[model samples]
Target: MNKRPSILIVDDEVSNIEILSAVLEEDHDIYFATSGDEAIATARAALPDLILLDVLMPGTDGYEVCTSLKGDPLLADVPVIFTTALGDQEAEVKGLELGAIDYIAKPISPVVVRARVRNHLEMKRMRDDLAKLAVTDALTGLGNRRRLEQALNIETARLALTSGTLSVIILDIDFFKRFNDLYGHTAGDRCLTMVAAALNRAVHHASDLTIRYGGEEFACVLPETEHDRAMDIAHGIRERVEALNIPHSGSDVAATVSVSIGVATAACVPGATPEAWVKAADAELYKAKAAGRNSVSGRTFQVVVEDARPLSSTA
Candidate 1:
């Protein structure tokens, strides 16, 4: 079952909060705050889909609360609705300027409140769906290049603070172009999908990301993983793809489809760059291709606090 959308109601008067909750509780999960400071704290904690805020409060009025919500990166996108007794146009304009999506006058009509909340929630859901689709691969149902970059940026930034380990694996289907020419594009697409599924199965952690990195190539971003563990996963992927037994008549490596993998691991530091990490992996990929198309090549980098240097080790 789908989870119900949540709402946070902020009003100084206990009666006002109870009224809004009575109206919204059946269709949505409801939370309440009695002051503007409490409203901001509750919004951050609950991450509500929509916030119904009262304009008049003892401290930190609704306008100030809305400003703080808009300023927070994690809470910025949450929709805010001002529920205030101030019926004047100037007051409404001020709330809108501070990023409230809608202004509802006091002696609120339940029907209008319901309609506005439903409309805004639907709009938020659509925006979220579009955002996900933008980073998804159409054919493979895996994350695309854009998603990979986003994950890398986030994980690496976390690493800077935590001094944790990060790993990346790049895999390429052996003789993919020849396979396409021999079996046709449709068969090639089927092959790609199958490989993507295998990769999804291989990654065990929720934080790990498997990406379709353009044609014939794929990538994995593993956070808080060590060199030996990353190499093991890479080898597992190579074995899994070969085990699929998707026939590749044009291949030199094996009768069945196979992959060459490159792995890179590093102890992350403040000055580290994701591009350098990927480049190291790509260099290993070149080596894997040169040695033979159905193998894994890997290296680990030890990062200094002040500088990053590659401490290459072949696997």
Candidate 2:
């Protein structure tokens, strides 16, 4: 709320647009796009904090534009307001039903327009920041366990609805305890950071959440990604870390950093709980360690990490 925000005013009539812009300029970074299409394009480009749209226009009107904006994944969160002279109860109801956050009757007062827009923008900023903190792990700046669980729940539900396929991969740095014992905890911290970056890059899909799974381990929650594809991503992370060539006491690559990975995937189908999905991936990670070290193992392969143990949830 303290930061300056960009606001877009969409109207076909030049005078109405100018008046609204003049009213809002001192409070926000204002942009005007006369047509519905132009407004949507500008909204997307600017990622504006708020949108003031005209209900009646020559071609595409505000309702259609609002629906389209709501349908898009990236633009849906930006709040929209219908600004029109149509004061009927039905018109206001329709505008609200079209996913606009508010409707402002035309013959607009600068005070009303500025006040409502500012209030909604403040709410949007607060909501966004709060949602971010809920999803992020404060310690590592990665997705926390709660966020991971939420992502899995949502993804699993979508898969059932859409019949898509996805994979989850779990990885652990082999013999991390002994390495920490030798090089100290600070070096271990550096290793974790490097692996996190590698995982973030290796998983190219925007839907994927690279999570720090507590300590000495991580998980990649990948959607629309299958088993072979998941293994490919895992191998990519493994190879990249090996290339870093950090010396570790007991790893195959030099000595510093080698990771054992386990990947599990499920199709958009019934009978797959998120817990069961991760259990499969966890089993595979242990197999990688048992088969030796410095490798990527899938649910099909049987490898085991030394002192490998399944983690139980405190919840």
Candidate 3:
């Protein structure tokens, strides 16, 4: 069954809240707040599909609330409609400029409110679907490179503030090109899918993210993890891929499928950036590949100075 969308109604007047709630409650899970602060809190907590905002309020008026919501990363995507009694053209223009998707002037009509809410909700659903498609890999059903980079940036920033550790593991299928040449691209694609699934299964932590990092390589972002734990996870990934027993006749290393992994961890400092972390991991990956294909190599580094310069690995 399709779940009903949620809507947040923010108004300072009791009658306004009650009327809107009565209209929208039948179709949506309704949440209401009588003040701007309460509205912001409720919207953040509930993450409603849409917001019905009143422009005139005592404190943190509707315009201020809308601006706040648009500024927040978590709430930025939610659509907002101004439900104001101020029917002037200037008022509507200001609300739209402040990031409201639509403005509906009151004395409220239940039918108009219902239709506008439904239309906006449908539009939101489509936009969300398209956004997901943009960040997801169609072949392996893992996150694509764009998503990986975004996640890496977010994690790195988070760890910098907390002085926590973040690790990245880069895994490449051993002799993947040879496999594709010998077995045909169809089989090679199947191999990638299998390997992607194995890597996804090996990292069980909710905070860990696995992504398809371009052709023949995959990446795992592990936040708040240490070097030893990252190595263990890397080894587990190698073992899982091998256990799949996919025949690799072109390879000299093993009779079946195998992978090489490089792991890099950062004890994040103020200046640390996502690119440096990935570069460090890529360097380790080069070492692993050079050491002869099917193996795991890992190192740890710390950010130095305020510039976020990376120091040579202490590992």
How well is each residue in 230-277 modelled by candidate 2, as lDDT tens digits? 888999989987877778875554466889999887774543456766
User: What are the per-residue Cα lDDT tens digits for candidate 3 across 1-315?
Assistant: 998999999999989989999988988899999999999989867989999999999989999999999976558889999988777899899889989999888999999999999999999999989988988999999988887877776676556767989999998999999999999999999999999999999999988999998899999999999999999999999999999999999887999989999999988766676777788888899899999979999899875545543332221
lDDT tens digits, residue span 192-261, model 1: 9999999998999988999998899999999999989999999999989988999988999899999999
RMSD to native, candidate 1: 6.1
lDDT of 1: 0.88
Candidate lDDT values, in order? 0.88, 0.80, 0.89
Off by over 4 Å in 3: 1-4, 12-19, 30-46, 153-167, 203-208, 222-233, 264-272, 290-292, 298-315
TM-score of each: 0.72, 0.62, 0.78
Q: How many residue pairs clash in each candidate?
A: 0, 13, 1
Report residue 262 deviation for candidate 3 (angstroms). Answer: 3.2
Q: Rank the candidates by TM-score, best first.
A: 3, 1, 2
How much is 233 displaced in model 1, in angstroms? 4.2
The candidate with the higher lDDT, 1 or 2, is: 1
lDDT of 3 at 259: 94
